[model samples]
Target: MTSPSFNPYHEWLGIDPSISAPDHYQLIGVPRDEQNPETISRAADAAMSRVRQVRPGDKSQEWARVLDELREAKSCLTNQGR
Candidate 1:
């Protein structure tokens, strides 16, 4: 399905009929308030933790990517502190 909000393509969840004007939007997905960033970050942390638990042999680009995400998240919070 395409994004009902704007995109020429639908998003994973499906269309939301509540959004009347689809073309004006950039993309369609769950709203931030409904799917908060903190909630998403927690899910990401859990997945990364599981990977470390099962495979402690070494880290890979995937782990690095997760770390980068963590760094970015940290920056956001720290910047807010300023």
Candidate 2:
């Protein structure tokens, strides 16, 4: 049985259990309190780096969705209102 915290989407996105959530910041593994563009960029890059290693296989669609979410997260967080 899967753990209560085990989410296939989060697993596919390479998001650690401790940082997993529906929000953009959590999706990118960046703290929501952080507002610096450079810091967010670095964190997004690191998070994407981990996610990019996933071989799509049967989950290609899901993988693509997560990648899109990461991109959106980066865009949103880098914007002023974040």
Q: Which stretches of candidate 2 lie over 4 Å from their true place?
A: 1-6, 13-21
Q: In model 1, what lDDT does residue 47 have?
A: 40
What TM-score does prediction 1 earn? 0.30
Worst 10 residues of 1 by lDDT: 21-30
TM-score of each candidate structure, all chains considered together: 0.30, 0.75
**Tens digits of per-residue lDDT for model 2, 1-80:** 33566464557655565664578877776777898999998888877777788776766766677778888888888987
Best by lDDT: 2
Model 2 TM-score relative to the real fold: 0.75
